[model samples]
Target: MNSGLNFLQTNVNKDFTTLKKNLKKDFTGLKKIKVALLGDSATQFLNQALRACAYEQGFEFEIYEADYNQVSRQLLDLSSDLYQFAPEFVIVFESTQKLQHKFNSLQKSERLQLSELKTEEVKNYYHTLNRQLKAKLIYFNFSEPMDGQFGNYSNKTSFSFLYQVRKLNLELMNLSQECKNLFILDYQALSAHLGRQMAFDAKMFYGASMNLSIDGLPLVAKNCCDIISAINGKFKKCLILDLDNTMWGGIIGDDGIENIEVGDLGNGKAFSDLQQWARQLKQRGIILAVCSKNDEQTAKEPFLKHPEMVLRLDDIAVFVANWNNKADNIRYIQSILNIGFDAMVFLDDNPFERNLVRTNLPEVEVPELPEDPSMYLEYLSALNLFETASYSEEDELRNKHYQQEAGRVIAQKNFTNEDDFLKSLGMTSKVEPVNKFNLPRVAQLSQRSNQFNLRTVRYTEEDVLQISQSENYFTLTFDLKDKFGDNGLICVVVLKKEVSALFIETWLMSCRVLKRGMENFTLNTIVEVAKKNNFKKIQGEYLATSKNGMVKEHYARLGFSEAGQLWELNIENYQTKKSFIQLN
Candidate 1:
């Protein structure tokens, strides 16, 4: 077993045994989220695993576990314990065998009808819960059986049990398109990757009707918590890699660039495959950084000159190759990136270097790599370190955008005065209401943004569409560009109209545009909108979270007076300040 997978398994067992150790501890002072886990079979072990995973990520989770095999009963009964708990998130885990059992008693034609009826029942459960309270629903899809009676031809036979389950999974995918709060947990993907035989234990299923084997329960639970954490805006944004033995086979300093092993031959194929994976991630908005203990010029040779290398100098957002301590190098990289330490994952081949960074900077996720290079990619995939909930067109250009920002930082050093530097950038912004064209990127920002978010509320594209159509709500997205490059969709602000006051429901901006006078520009726009709408004052609130402490005094700094926890700026007294940003 590789170190990453071995750690996951060990944590699963240790967490299950020590579940209550941090039940009441709130180290980060984040809100205690309430969650209910509803399942059709024995799910106590899964619940335990979720609690442990939540605590590991510094979230205080109040998980309400429903009775065994009582998913339908609790969802149907309005007065049941599930409704009384009033969870903010609901997870419904249903097993394939349970549905198969029902299909066995039905006729051949009734199988399709059975699938439709079950889907409708699940829809009704969501509708019933939404009518009573606001809860995001995570519905688990069916994990296909290992084998069917028809063998390999089961997919061609519509009447086969496997065919019915496959159709049901497709229906669930379609349902997610219509339901704004419904998210499908792809158990089929996880099971297919882990192999169905290992995923299900026949002895445990017959004895206690468990949905998964004891070994597989941990993976299911971990993935469930991973989805929840992503909803709460906890995910990795950067992948820092090492050069010598990690990215390729040999050292570029000792063996010349021509002698390095990176092509598709023998041991070199593994390194080439690893580079391909990293390049794909870079294209999809993951910031790539290089931290190696070697000469900087020597390290740059391969990316600059090698024909077989998949990654070039342009693909990296920050490249730091020096003889400094690995921990200190990561800190320097973090400073330039301006992201939280917890949002980084460092990959190095040497166990000594990994342990040194892990001990000094515990927040940086240094994955334990195996000795052999062949197992590197598989180990990283098994850890699932890069799971994301949303994507948009802007993701593809994120690396180039950040690289341009780095250039601006260097350009600012030549100018002595800060105002001169801001003026030199020739910054321009286009502020407009959210529309069909930019809805996906707007929603993506709401889901992933954490540090600069004032209220820390997440919304889907459907939710933003409703706000755009509503008369009482105002949705605005800001796109910024300077002389260097375009920072796509940099800011988002959602305002709700009260009788006399305009409430700032959501306000978040990209950290890349911080210290560039974007906040003053955004606030000036808000005041102009307020005056035109005949409002008395504008109100904003900052909900304190561990990640959003950087913006705790955001309103105060913008000249808004504090009224309890709410900040108010009277329209009559509002002063529209001149900004360097030219608005369009």
Candidate 2:
């Protein structure tokens, strides 16, 4: 009887153990940040954070980190390789340590290997090669290729030699550019600044049995924080500044502009630091506006003549150097920019001003300013944010870009015809698919782009990779380069192939490039892709969203017929359809 009882107890415990494990697994599935990783160990690092974060949140992550790290020759080819994982974004991290090493290593190699790369364009060559190698290694998350597809597509291709690596990366960059869903994570900048040996004491995954140390990855938690902050920033715009204590020291009207402590020496150091930092913001794509009650010239002189002043007149997107209520100034700034209330950031030195704005413009983001003025530097720097996947040279010229916009408006005043005004602005639009070179920006767009999204499916860098590799999944990204300079990657088109049919899953564009004919160009590219794949019919589903009503008839205009509520277009019929614009 004792032995029988013992046996029953043992079996019951075994069943309980099974139940616990299964419950944990189910809970993990629910909480895991599902990422389909692409590229090098950098991707692995991001996964580690995600895993940790999931555990802490009482969830588990479903991730696929590619065994190889080289990018695909094209995003179109992604459907053939990594698409099975079904990731949220295609995570691509840059390795700063390897860029110089690879370039130097290549330089010492054979002359034949260096044939394709321009010696003078060493930086460009190295970057291109890095993408190729990383993509090859990262494109395949698992050890093997899908059932029957190419296992080592990067290697099987001709001229994949190390010396000829630049050639491979160039092609991969092109491929990624074509895929709209490819999200490239550039941890390189952080690693480059912080050095490769750097690790963080940042928050890690809690309650996780699978202890993957963050030290295994380079930028770790801090970079992850940056990634999060960046995603949160894109949908935001405008900055409202406080006058008396925030911009400078003491009351501006009482102390006088010269008496205001805003210099490199003495107590003015903090104010100078703030000015310089704020000045740099305009260069890095953030808008700055001020609110103060003082004589306009007095409030403006520090920026004009103070030797220690870091900011310039041009940097101020808008400012109210008057006694008027600050909340009113912020409202005016928002109206002038045509931006929404939620996109604004309010900064005040006084509790009164901050609270007033909070009550009135509740949508505006108001991060609590530190009480001690000495901590302002660290406080503001923490909030600068790592938004968008990448920043190009044009990003530095944000003020100039907007200035040109103002010029366009002013030039319009002198011209009677809209066409003539547009023609005078000398606008030029260059539309291209998302590539490895622009993958970071594309991913940034995926995260931040809200208004023009057909379906706002925000993806991280890793999710983009799985989509890129998804069998028959095609992602198309578009760039707008007009007289306003490059708006960078501004539009995206995600295509999913279900057996013989092509499903237009998600199509979105940035509001910045709206009404500029980018949509037509993107539609044209989709038309061409569907024709090439011989998809039975181009189909799209509209779920009747609040913001996507503008696109309600998108497929219909592209020659699609409505089947009940679903839109379907024949490839043959779409081939002949023409819009008012021409695409290359």
Candidate 3:
């Protein structure tokens, strides 16, 4: 292990203590979100850590915590307080000790039956909650026991108590595929990362029935915050890497491309692994950019000529290699990408450079890099910085698609007239209702799109599926293609039909398709849907958010008259809007 990460994981106990002391009031400008925590063991410390973590990430949390050992009662009863709380999120963290106690008390012949019954009860509870409330569920899996009586044979024995716990965890994972709103919190993974000895304190477990040690609370809380942030569309989308000693073993400017240590030998393997990891992220829609303190030509040599380089020029969306300050360079990269500073992660080997960027751009995440190159991959994997809430097929080709977008920008300079430029691109759109094939992408747009999202409401895949299947609701998904490339599944709009009006429930689009008349095309489609359904009025709304200020005047720009907080256009009086996009 590197000294830097070792120091960080070991010395953060004091910081967490200070954090718990200062968790009295919520921060300003954060959205108020309600949550309920139901667990089998004492969970006051976990709740405290959750609040502190949530507040740090700009969330004003109103938590409803049920008493210990109330999981079964709160879940089974329809009129329970858990349902009455009407939480937006429900977190369940049942203790492994309780599961083991039940298994140990059962006779040998009844062990397998007990596991089956417990799994069925859990599934029923989830189904009941899904039917009764709109809240998203976060259920934790069981942790392994410290010691099993059968020792090495415990996993091999099918009817053993330890074996049943493993079976239950696997069953939960498989069940999540069927339950769209159910997300499994991998507590066992966290326990393994921190080591079982450090995660479980026997004295605390015996005295107070605490599942995790006091020092382990902060890490667990951090993982919980990562999940919450990703669900709310606040996770990082870009990674800015520094070359030379950072991506390799030596300074590229001094050692030249041939001498830089990045191959399959010795310390080189670490940098090679790091590059492979970055390449995988690129394939999954995370933008990669290079910001190094070397000449542009010099930095290009390694990616161009190195035999073992996993990342090439085509993989990088933006490359800014100059002697200028890194903070300034990162701002330039953000401009080209059109993303917020909070969505970028800066990785540099120099402590001074990392501190410089952190001071200048406080929103950017600057992780403390380990001094030893060999520890880079392991340390980063433990952090889980790129956790995602959803995925789609389009994500795999995101890097190539963005490269084509850059080409379009250059092509635009060749034409003086804006309309001629747009026409030259041969832009076409396919407007269709959301179906089983496009359900995942539609839900992802709702979860990850913030700046282009009006009203900023989030929905799970299950919620979107229900909306699509409803008779009175209309779900629209837009796909865009131009001369440059295909931008797949770029926009999503949900409309709910009332007695005489069709109300817009969601209006979100990808930033990449902005200023291309997609919004105008979408409005025309909305009116068409309303006319076909025999609705009298088409109603919309624009909720102002710090990130969505660009769209505050969206309805007004589309000629909809404002009626207090709502915008409305009478279907008979509405005029069709013209657009260059050919709709299918």
Question: What is the per-residue lDDT of model 2 for residues 48-144, given as tens digits with 9 covering 90 to 100?
Answer: 5555444432345466766533433322244434454544334444332233234456644443454234322333422443343222112211111
Ordered list by lDDT, greatest first: 1, 3, 2
Q: Would you estimate the TM-scores of all the predictions? A: 0.94, 0.56, 0.96
The CA lDDT of each predicted structure is: 0.85, 0.55, 0.85
| Model 3 TM-score, all chains together | 0.96
- Please provide, for model 1 over 46-103, each residue's C-alpha lDDT reduced to its tens digit, 9 standing for 90 to 100: 7777776678777767889988789888878889999999998899999998888888
| Per-model C-alpha RMSD | 2.6, 14.5, 2.0
Return the TM-score for candidate 1, rounded to 2 decimals.
0.94
Task: For residue 506, give model 1's deviation from the true position in Å.
Answer: 1.8
lDDT of candidate 1 at residue 535, scale 0 to 100: 88
Q: How much RMSD separates candidate 2 from the native structure?
A: 14.5
lDDT-superior candidate, 1 or 2: 1
How well does model 1 score by local distance difference test?
A: 0.85
Clashing pairs in 1: none
Candidates 2 and 3 compared by lDDT, better number = 3
Off by over 4 Å in 3: 1-15, 113-115
